[model samples]
Target: MAEFDLIERYFTFEYDFTQASNGSANNKSSQKNKKPKVVKGIGDDCAIFEIPEKYQLVTSTDTLVDGVHFFSDLEPELIAHKALAANVSDLAAMGAKPLAFTLSISLPEVNQDWLKSFSEGLKNASKLFKVPLVGGDTTQGPLNINITAYGSVKKGRLLERNNAEVGDDIWVTGYLGEAAAALELYDKALVQKAALNHSEAELWKALTQPIPPLKFARKLTKLSRCGLDISDGLTADLGHILSKSQCGAKVCVESLPVSEALVNFVGLEQARQYALNGGDDYQLCFTASSKHRNKILNLAERCQINVTRIGKVQDEGLQLNLNGQPFESNRVSWQHFNQ
Candidate 1:
């Protein structure tokens, strides 16, 4: 797509402030009154501010290295999107609304096209989440993108994984296994179908863009006991929650929500495994009281998002069960330092 088309199609719709930086005086004035304390700084700067009464700022950062977090040949814009989305996912895990972010990018060469596309994607994501780009750094090195996202939660409202209770219902937003299916297509021998059903373009889109669910964070904190984003597969990431919560869980394999694209690419059994153990999905997996069932359902319907009740918290330990038997949830992911 052309740069203008990309900005209009993807970035503009999600980002509220896309036109704010277009050298329009009215747009600049609109920005100034929104948050007065953010002091202006130069060179991709984010203005620092204090919210005196309502909220406390929550911050998180993530780093993506070439040949590790993503492929070198992938679109620069998508890399920027994914890098920012990953950090947004962290904020969502805390049930925080993103306010702004700063980016630090290191590159081996100065490619104008790459920078343009990357900035567009980052701007798009920031706008979509109502986050403004405050500041950043650029340097020459192997391709790496580091983003620090700032958000806020109403006094003491941030959710933590350690707050889960034994009887809480385990829920997850969106279907699983799409990202894993996209990864499988990277291998020619695997020859998986596209990411979405009945469209090669749609499949390619999912592979290129994974939407991070920031909208659900506030509602989730209200409805859930605890939660986390499903980055390192459901089984693996939930293990962190369960371990921290001092509890165990039973993931009903039969209840996992799998995409039609996944079922077409891999058979039922392996597809279930991918949804269970595959990584980088970036969806929210949470625990809520059974009493909040109606509230959660209403929230999902209002948001037009799918949330599956895959399992329940158990008092014993982390074990997944299907039919009448017990299974393991201690699957390992691609650890940064594997022995």
Candidate 2:
């Protein structure tokens, strides 16, 4: 199919740009519930958005190339879901509410079945996040999917990596390392072996369809001073926060939330390494004051997300400790250039 025709058929969805742009909705309920205004969308050369007064726009872009980001033979729907989710995860890390996104995809050939499934996944995620697909481009090339997601947060409410403070408590949302474990299984051709017990299958889902901690991150914006999504594993990504904040951290290895699936598949020690260095988990790792412990716990309870305190910010350098003794590991998280 031609590019414009392909986009029209698969990507274009009905949106009342006029009403949205004016910040006026016919539905009384919608009017009562504030939503971002999209002044102009897909048909335009550039998407125009009207940020509500006192709100700041947060934008992040992520690209996935076949063979690099995922297996080339993976399902098209999953590729679509993961491509967009990766970008959305960036927004979550910033405690922003997703607004809209643009997709740019390059394809070697037009496969109707693949496009159909991919569009379905994209639409499903857009609906789930209440973010509209605005505009993008399609070109002929090696398979690639790039998404630029936009979100909004109230002015002065945005989280930052450099805001971590000495003596702050470090926390992470949900389990980690499952995606990395899944990748290891795939890399070693042990998937079938691990899948015998369904562990590999669960990890595969975690790798392909990561759920960004959007709601939790939003709540955390109010409770925490600084944070980020753990895409590059805890050791590396947390290092980023420490580096930016000019502080160090002492992590309790026993407190790491290693998933049962990962532990069963790789055993406890190996799973710890995966949790430490395995990337793509997309959970939030953040820092807040000790005074907010009860409030943070209450917020996690209300959000139905498991938030764990794994460490404390310090003055010098990152350290991993187990039972008050130093733990040693040379593993580093995934880095595109280094890998």
How does each model score on lDDT?
Answer: 0.73, 0.86
Q: What is the lDDT of residue 325 in candidate 1?
A: 78
- lDDT at 222 for candidate 2? 84
Q: Write candidate 1's Cα lDDT for 219-292 as tens digits.
A: 77777758888887888789899889989988888889887767776776777887887778888998989999
What is the per-residue lDDT of model 2 for residues 1-339, given as tens digits with 9 covering 90 to 100? Answer: 788999999999777666544335576655555556677889989998877566889899988878889876777778888888898899999999888899998889999998999999898888777788999999999988899999998878888999999999999999989998887656543334443457777888899899898988887888886988999889999999999999999999989999889999899998888888888999999999999999999999998988899999999799999889999875788888888
User: What TM-score would candidate 2 get against the native?
Assistant: 0.92
**Worst ten in a row by lDDT for model 1:** 36-45
Over 4 Å off in model 2, which ranges?
A: 15-35, 187-196
Candidate 1, pairs of clashing residues: 14-128, 15-127, 15-128, 44-135, 45-134, 45-135, 46-134, 46-135, 195-203
Taking all chains together, each candidate's TM-score versus the true structure is: 0.83, 0.92
